[model samples]
Target: MTTYKRMVLASRPKGVVSPQNFRLEEVQAPALKDGEVLIRNHYLSLDPYMRMRMEDVKSYAAPQAIGETMIGGTVGEVVESKNPKYAVGDKVQGMLGWSEMGVSDGVMLRKLDTTHVPLSAYLGSVGMPGMTAWYGLTQIMQPKEGETIVVSAASGAVGSVVGQLAKLRGCRAVGIAGGKEKCDYVVNELGFDACVDYKAGNLVDDLARATPNGIDAVFENVGGTIFDECVARMNPFGRIALCGLIAGYDGEPMALNNVRNILTMRLTMRGFIVSEHMDLWPQGLKELGTLVATGKLKFRESVAQGLESAPEAFIGMLKGKNFGKQLVKLV
Candidate 1:
């Protein structure tokens, strides 16, 4: 039997998660069942949504149970297969968690053609985060030419794509990110019209300057003060797609001071989970894949060394340390 390493949720976190919250263990891989396919994960995706799973709270999805393998998305190659649908040597992506190897019955896995795009791209730009940006911007926001669209966490996996898509549709894209370096990348590389550094201590003023005509739409990822500032500058009939609230993911309570803007500005705000909208995945993924393959869309990633480093990398990502998509190079 082949032995593989995996990380399991040891305990629910209180406030911020630490290394102690996770336990690394080595387990022997079992022989494949009649319909099972075994994969050797090459890369593991680390995303913000994983944080919410760590808490034992009522949510759109169930909390990660203690002693369960830490949930995650992964890209890997099939090493053994008992199913006729999936052949050995096939590359696939699935919710296989934070393990060096995983087994599945081929229900949730999607085969990947790595010739068109890199393997890791399936975890970021042409994958869930990219699809998220598409659903939020094109469906909810519906931004038009000459309109101003603001995106929070602008240099992140979803936010970067949001800004780029807005610009592609002829809207003026403004981004809000953490530091000067990320802000620079958002503006210069991603083609955002302007980027404001939230940590610069001039969030409100900088936002005001960026959206001189007021924001027509917002792709909100970070909540709390940043969200409040965006709401305060929203134009009448503006749309807000509430994708994530990373600011409060560590159990902090986020209070929005601009609640009245929803009524006063006649704004429309919608909170959605990308997974729930399976109907749109085909359309969104096709467009995202084409854009990425054609070089029209761009993205970056911060890769950690191995499975053992996932905890620290995940903790750092929550604290805004990652530049773009954060991934663990399991291979």
Candidate 2:
């Protein structure tokens, strides 16, 4: 019998997740069933969306059940396989629950070609984050060249790509982040036209100065007070692609006092989860690959040491401590 360490959700969180909400447990690995593969996790992505899963509520994905191994997206190497399509030593990304060692029925695991990029990137740039940014910007917002665009949490995994993509398309990108370093990186390194420091306590004023011409498109990531400013600044026929709401992922729903702004600005807002667009992920990955291969796309990750560090990573992400993609290296 093979036993592996697994992190299980201990209880539902109140507002913010603490260490008490998770428990490290030992579980025996089940025998390989038909069309299944055994794998050891290499990297796991810690996303803000996982915060929403901790609570029992209505969401795009079901809430993590009590006592389960939690949930996450991970990259792994196959060690044993009953599936003909996959071989031992193949690296893959699986929408597997949280565990050091796991078995997949081959349903959620996607075989990745490491010859193109690093295997860890499958959980970051070219994977969910990249696809989410691509779909939200190209398909949802549909901004034209020379337009002014703004995205909140612009230094994050999805928002960073969203701003860069807008810049590459000839739009002026204004980013809102937490500090001066991240703001400068977005403007100078990621190529955004300007960046505002939300921690500076001048978001609305800074946004006004940055986008004097008004915002034509917004790729919304954090939704709280920023959502108010976005609605006010959006021009007529402006587009908004709702991504994540890390600001309001707790037990309470987001508090918004300005519903009249939507009608006044004539904003076209659409909310979507990345999982719903898996059909387009192939095309998204191919295009993103070309962009990355040509040095047009850049990625940053705040890597944690091991699987046990996932909880700390998750906590940091929720507190807006991460500047870019946050990942836990399991192996």
Candidates in order have lDDT scores of 0.95, 0.87
Q: Can you write out model 1's per-residue Cα lDDT over 1-331, one digit (the tens) per residue?
A: 7999999999988899999999999999998899999999999999999999998889999999999999999999999999999999999999999999999999999999999899999999888999899999999999999999999999999999999999999999999999999999999999999999999999989999999999999999999999999999999999999999999998788988899999999999999999999899999999999999999999999999999999999999999999999999999
- Estimate the overall C-alpha local distance difference test score of candidate 1: 0.95
Error in Å for residue 34 of model 2: 2.5
Worst 10 residues of 1 by lDDT: 248-257
lDDT of 1 at 298: 96
Error of 1 at 4 (Å): 0.2
Candidate 1 clash pair list = none
Per-residue lDDT of model 2, residues 221-322, tens digit only: 888898778778888889989997778877557865666767887878899988887889989899887777677888889998866888888898888888
Per-model TM-score, in order, reads 0.99, 0.97
